[model samples]
Target: MTRRRHPSLWIAMALATSSLSGCRCSEPPAEKEEPAKASPTIQRGDAVLVEPNAGDFFEARVLGLEPAAGIQSLKLQRSDGEITTADAVDVYKLPDESAAAAASKQPGLAPGRLVICEVAHQRWVGCRIKTVSEDGYQIEDFGGEEHRISLKKLMLPSELTRMNLEQRFKIGDRRRAFEREAARAGQPAPPPGFSPGFKERVIAKRGDEWFSAHIVRFHDDGAFRVRWMADDRENDVAKVEVIPEPPYQQPPKRGGFVLLKPNVQSLPWARWRVVSVRPELVLQNAAGEQSQSSRREVVPLDPDVAASDEESP
Candidate 1:
């Protein structure tokens, strides 16, 4: 029996088959894989901002690595003066220092720029190179103490290394360049150490917080342009906001006494002599050989006390 289905039934079956085919054509396409991103390199003594989690960032200084834990492990000193530990994977260099220029394989290190070098016991200290030679680098630390640090131990700040300290100061706005020249002619000169390129700790008005920065240039009235290296920020801070951090190497007058560290491994309390002040505060004992003390470890004795120490047996 060539019994055929109704014409309507035949039409329904045809439509059903077409719909199934269309469903297959409408299937979603596979997604392509994205390329891998490169990770940033970080090392000890570099300034960085760390991210503990999503959206939270903290400013920190890299103390060093804890290889026993992992290559990614690091010791950090926070902006608030607190010392803590972190992971290298979680830390990132500042925008201006993203290239890790200081850590590069190139050969370029000059004097007068601030650099972080590994000091005694692998301690990282911020210092300026007084002299660079084939022998080694003579590092003048923040405390004004001098050290003979190896070239391999130095971590040159990318910005400061490539650019002189004077250039880093954002002197002014559009008219600042011309204004500086005009003002220099007639205005009373700023006192020494307050002039351009003087590094000091500044107190911010926003949070009344204290941070290290350097004077860029002096303004007509009393304002001074300053550069904050921690975040690569520059602005004008009032004279009042700027205060000098007394360096430990102040040379006292002849026949006068100054507080000093008794031994390389001792606390800074012993009263020492005033051989000369220029270049650096030179102190000595009955024995010869120049010794250095940290600014934090040294204190100045009042003239009255200094005189008494000198007169003492």
Candidate 2:
């Protein structure tokens, strides 16, 4: 929904008199100036979803326009024939078919005819039309609810469906672009399922600051085209660099031998045989010397190496 200023207010003015004897009367009595009136975002006959109550939205048609509490309000009728009012900011417009999409429809279907259209996969529903023209057609269902369906859907109902404006920009044609980004950002994809173009936190290489970003496009070589989630700057950033999180590789099992990294003595990384389990790792060298070290110092065990024959089973 588009947001703009509410409607202006009505101000009572003082009586005005023609300037007489070269003297301005009353210095144009002080009056409160009216605020600038915003143009209505939704039109009289637009297809929109209106939120009649908080968190509850309903599909409705704009029947009239009026001012409600110094704001632009719309009179709408729902599919179930309920008439209610809502502010312009609460109206969401459905997507219109692009020029390329309209040309692909089946050849000769006129308005005022009852037709069945595929609303979803393997689902067909009946629709009635108000008027049809080159620009667009107004339509309603049996329940009298209006919708902005693509004209192309009326033709090849099997292969086509109504494309929403929000879906086109956020969820269609660029789904993988978002996934590759979530991978790079070290953020998990939504557990339930994928949401295309959803934003997640990413550390920027520039300042090393964490910022919200998402993929807007994808390169052939598997790089992300990113967009900033920052409200001040919604610019698209190409090829956002992401640092991979360090893999959590566990050390060798306590009963097994392991190697430890060098200590402050500048000693080399050493191979040690695990002698016992404790808060600190107890290790023995091949020389029959035992050393105490932090469990974290042990490196991962080599997959190709077999257990040492020196084990005390």
Best by TM-score: 1
In order of listing, the candidates' clash counts read 0, 0
Residue range 220-276, candidate 1, lDDT tens digits = 787778776456578887765554333323424543444453343212234454466
Tens-digit per-residue lDDT, 145-248, candidate 2: 56655554442211111222222223322444433432343321122222223343332222333344455565666455555444424443334343211111
* Model 2 misplaced stretches (Cα beyond 4 Å): 1-58, 62-70, 81-83, 88-175, 178-247, 250-313
What lDDT does model 1 reach? 0.46
- Stretches of model 1 off by over 4 angstroms after superposition: 1-105, 158-313
- How far does residue 250 in candidate 1 sit from its true spot (Å)? 28
Each prediction's TM-score against the native? 0.25, 0.22
Pairs that collide in candidate 2 are: none
Question: Would you list the C-alpha lDDT of every candidate in the order shown?
Answer: 0.46, 0.42
Among these predictions, the greatest lDDT belongs to 1
The deviation in Å at residue 33 for candidate 2 is 39
